[model samples]
Target chain A: MNTPEPFLGATSHTPVRHHILSVLVENKAGVLARVAGLFARRGFNIYSLAVAPAETKARFSRITIVVDAESAPLEQIVEQLDKLVNVVAISDIAPKDALERELLLATIKTDVDNRTSLLDVVGNYGAAIVDVDAGSVTLMLAGTPAACDELERELESYTTLELHRTGRVALPRLGKAAVAADPD
Target chain B: MGGLFLYLTKRIIVQLTGAQALIKSLEMEGVEVIFGLPGGAILPVYDPLIDSSVRHVLVRHEQGAGHMAEGYALATGRPGVAMVTSGPGATNIVTPIGNAHMDSTPLVVITGQVSSAAIGTDAFQECDITGITMGITKHNFLVKSAHEIPRAVAAAFHIATTGRPGPVLVDVPKDIAQSMMEWWYPASIEELDLPGYHPVVDLDADRVAQAIELIRVAERPVLYVGGGTLKSHASAQLLAFAERTGMPVVTTLMARGAFPDSHAQHLGMPGMHGMYAAVTAIQKCDLLISLGARFDDRVTGKIPAFAPHAKVIHVDIDKAEFNKVRRADVAIRSNVAAVLEAWDANQASPQNLEVWWKEINAWRETYPLVYDEPAVEGLLRPQHVIESIAKAAAPGTIVTSGVGQHQMWASQFWKFEEPGTWINSGGAGTMGFGVPAAIGAKAGRPDRVVWCIDGDGCFQMTAQELVTARSEGIPIKVAILNNAYLGMVRQWQEMFYDERYSEVYLSPDLPDYVKWAESMGCVGLRATNIEEMHAAIATANTINDVPVVIDFRTDSSEKVFPMVAAGASNDDIMVHPLQREQS
Candidate 1:
């Protein structure tokens, strides 16, 4: 008689270090389910997850996952990622090589008619006014995933009825390129 | 004597480099033969292989080699190995690789990759084989250097065979394959921390005692076996427990051959297509002892109604599977053999529920599994086709099936006399798995009959397999239960979709699958009626040169009953002969 245990064994191990993994996956329905299922099945804690289309053609998507692990099982993660059928490749980029791993936020309508103070708050945060219609102004800001979230929290009091936020996206530093060695 | 010893030692060290070391590494890993296709990327390895003791069976297609390797591994309880070249050659094996991964079959797939220089440049015959196979395999490797080959091979074998067995791929660059290096077999595995690798073999004493007490106090108990039993090779331990407790046992589809069919205590498969007696027993029993079985939806029916009267005790090697669906009174995370051995030491006779057994026996007699009069009038019944195959299929024959009505019928009618005789994608429920799995099975056990049973829809999905089968000269018989439609979906729509027939009718006209088979250099036959079915079977049985597809059209309206509706629990089974539609 075999007894079943937790899919992810005992939770006794000390938390290693937090790892931020950016993934490029084929855009498809249930892709998230497949990825999430693998993490659940393997028993990995996902501190944060953000997703968006990587390419405008909608063929590829980017998923940013922040995991609390001492040493990430990168090989196993890549191995278990069968859910993303169209995933062409996966790589872990050094944090320093990230030029812009950030999210963009835009609030269309704000009660700047009565609260002119909201405009000052947006300006203080180095946010841009993308559109100004009637008495309200549309503010836009781009920053790191956490920084963008922080700025939004402070802007919540400005009657922020409509808000649009872009999930985390990143590009390698200008000089960095991955190339395979030439065949002799 | 000293001079000879020195000479031998020096020669052994020299032989450990280049292709010689590769052959020795494979031999050390216990790889007896390789099923593969040869190409430029892999010529160096094969050249050395020709001089080595290892055997290689050249297959027509790379995919066939993968299937053959998987089959050999399933048959021998060892990892099956397949080798191939880059690009199409490597990509062709993806389907079988996925098959092994889903079925938990141990397989080793070694592909020759393009030289490192052509890897990302997309040069002639170059492909990202490692990337392509990543998800389908449990693990994968790209041998960047010759020194890494032996260690990578060792690790691949270890991972592929340990814990939950699955396929692993190692793509060796062409240059690396030809390079010479000082080969030192990695003496031990580095402690790669796998979260789920719990090495403790003993069952928790407290849990075991609790379960024993529960069993002793229970009035009625039934034991359920699952695929894990066969996977762990724990049939003997399970049999001992059954005899000791006089417990009635049933199995899941993947666990079909776990118990002898003739055993008096056997209750048959339980779930959607389970036996009437088995379903009723699961529903009515006061205590359920499950061994190495996952409570898959097909088995549990509707969760709330499944085993409502019973206190479940689920035993499985996977910790996450325990109480994941059905809450168990006692759940143990240990190997089947280990737990059963532990239980044997602390054995106690349980109180007998004589009346319950009598009732179960009465149900079995009254609802004895019978077919619809053998379709003697005109039509071919799927049941008849299965029975005919079973009669023709030799003992220890390999039966693989694709999903749908035909799969269920084959599982029910085929009397598997031994473990590992039946193979299918049970958990994944993948259609088109039959023919390839059969290909794999035959490659493993060349002397045994490998029958591929599929529904018309399922057969058409991977019918391309005929090319591989014919070219490989593996005599696997393909039996198609053609009902002229998606029978399972049609049945569902008939019962639930208001009988609209919607798009379920596969009636644009079947493009002479027989001709299609012949075009692929394989034999094909059609069974329009009962008499012709016999003829088709005869034809299939006689052909030993190539794979044959026998298309047998049957009545589409027939439903696989004694089904416990999804989530309805085991007791609320809807038996065939319609007691009335679900309210």
Candidate 2:
């Protein structure tokens, strides 16, 4: 009654390495779940993921993913994803060839005496306040991933109430902007 | 063409219920027969099927339908279709789906789902069939709208039969099957253009040149052929390549019939329970040409020690198969047949391997697949039964089996003369696969003789399919080696676990298979001695209108030889070490 084992490659105890994979898939109902299911069932570690309509029309979507290659190799993962019915193409976007960004939002508790100090601190990181409350100031920062990380590291002393960051999204610089990201 | 497309979409006025549309589409797909059962969620589909030209055989168990479909595909090289209801029906077919996936059998399993509103509510017969079968299927779809049926069905067939074949599933909810829509099947081949699944058939000429160079220079080169040879229908090309290169060939168990067994360069199956000559060739070869085969752990014992001196050149359709197990010095990810077609070896360097051939022939003679029948009174061994049956089988016979000692014996003894003639549950090794799968093969090719070599423990698992075979007039022969125990595990206990056999033995003569066969509308025969064994086989061979079952009360002590212990290297193979050989 046992099922056949999914063929897995020999694992090694090497240094952790990150790999960026761009997957183009058809825009179907369970396409996202199917791609995610492969990772869950195979025990591949996913660092981050982002999905948007691909350069095509509603027929396709592009999924950008960050993975820990040390845990599972990118070749096996891409091949497995390629087995999916809706998947269109898989490309590994090298960091040097693509522009990547991350967005972070931080809500800091501020008092009247120290509110000016926090404003100066937030302004230094090129962040703008999105909302204001009685005791908190919510700031949003969108930039290169490193820039957002630098801002988050510097804003730690402001008695931060809460913080959230979109993991990352990337696009190739020279080719063209995506053809199907609908403008609202 | 654009105006016609618009006109056809606008002018279509005939509306049929989803079930009718499904039946029509299946008719258009040229489906002549379907193996399935009806239940709450699938009654709508069944209703229209009764009036359709396609014939439906109602299976007693969903699992039988699945394996039958698998056998059908193997026999005809066409996609096999099975339909079952949701929940338990779907789960029952999971094993067959996995079996097909592992063996690369092309199958389309259509399972019923709960109504769209009741899908997640745990309605009667509700189960997530698509979700459950994601990993096992090449692709799966849960069709929410009746309008999606035409394209989805076409896509399922396309995905199932192309680019490394595997089982695909389409879960149709009850609402969609009963819903009404204007439908017409897709006509053009252009609609099947799958961009992501572009199977690159063009091989790198440099890789082929390198492979040819390696073949020319190597002293000892062996060809390891797997089931994909049969799947790609590349046996002729493979034979040509082997003959041209003069390299000895070893076929894996799944690839038993890929090359003719009688060929001089052909070594028998290799792995645990593999022949001595084949295993030795694999271990000693300087260059191993792996063709359309994944290096399964069963084939490569302990991984690292397997073929230590061999530089592998792996050629397969799937890219991931490269370095999946053994690393390939040169990897060509293309169709094996296509690659072989592109290979032009005009330079003839005749390098003689007379010494190597002599060594292989010597090993074949010294450690042949042989066993001594007992001189003791009335004790018939399983080996004798298999040997007798093997001698009696006609050319181009299709032999199937359940997983156990009997499978290994059949594999060892049966000389398959043609490709696509030997079918078994190789990867999944599901115990009940024999009877149903043989029935499927018989149904697909009524002109050929099909034999299911089964063990007592394995026979009981799906023997009820004998009734189905009788009803369908498949006329498949069942030869049960009645050992009264799970012989493989018992042999393991005797060797590895100090002979403490736990729950491995069945009650002696408990089920009375002779009477069971009779009740199932089969002519039952019993063979207690060598004379009756021959007579029983002769009698079975004569019966053409009805199915036959012959129960041979084989010696329980007989074990399969040339055994490699699980996770043990081939060099540590043991031949009847733990047991005494009777005169």
**Each prediction's DockQ?**
0.04, 0.29
* CAPRI grade of model 1: incorrect
Please name the candidate that would achieve the greatest lDDT relative to the true structure: 2
Question: What TM-score does chain A reach in every model?
Answer: 0.59, 0.80
User: Where in model 2 is the C-alpha error above 4 Å?
Assistant: A1-16, A110-117, A150-161, A175-184, B1-14, B344-350, B374-378, B578-583
Residues B1-583, candidate 1: write the lDDT tens digits: 9999888788444534455566678888988778888887877788888777777777766766776677677666889999898888898888889878877788888888888788789787888877666557776777778887887788788778876678988888888887888867867665332222222345688888888888888888888888878878988888898899888989889888888887898989988989999988988889988888878888887788788889988887655565567888998867777778878788844778688789999889877676667767766888888998788766788888888888888888888767888888786676677776687678767888888888888877767767777766777888888888888888878877788887778841486778887897888798888789888888788888788888787888787776665556566666767334422
- RMSD of each candidate relative to the true structure: 11.3, 6.7
Q: What's the count of clashing pairs in each model shown?
A: 27, 0
Per-residue error (Å), model 2, residue A38: 1.4
How big is the positional error of residue B220 in model 2, measured in Å on the Cα after superposition?
0.6
Give lDDT: candidate 1, residue B256.
85
How does residue B464 of candidate 1 score in lDDT?
Answer: 74
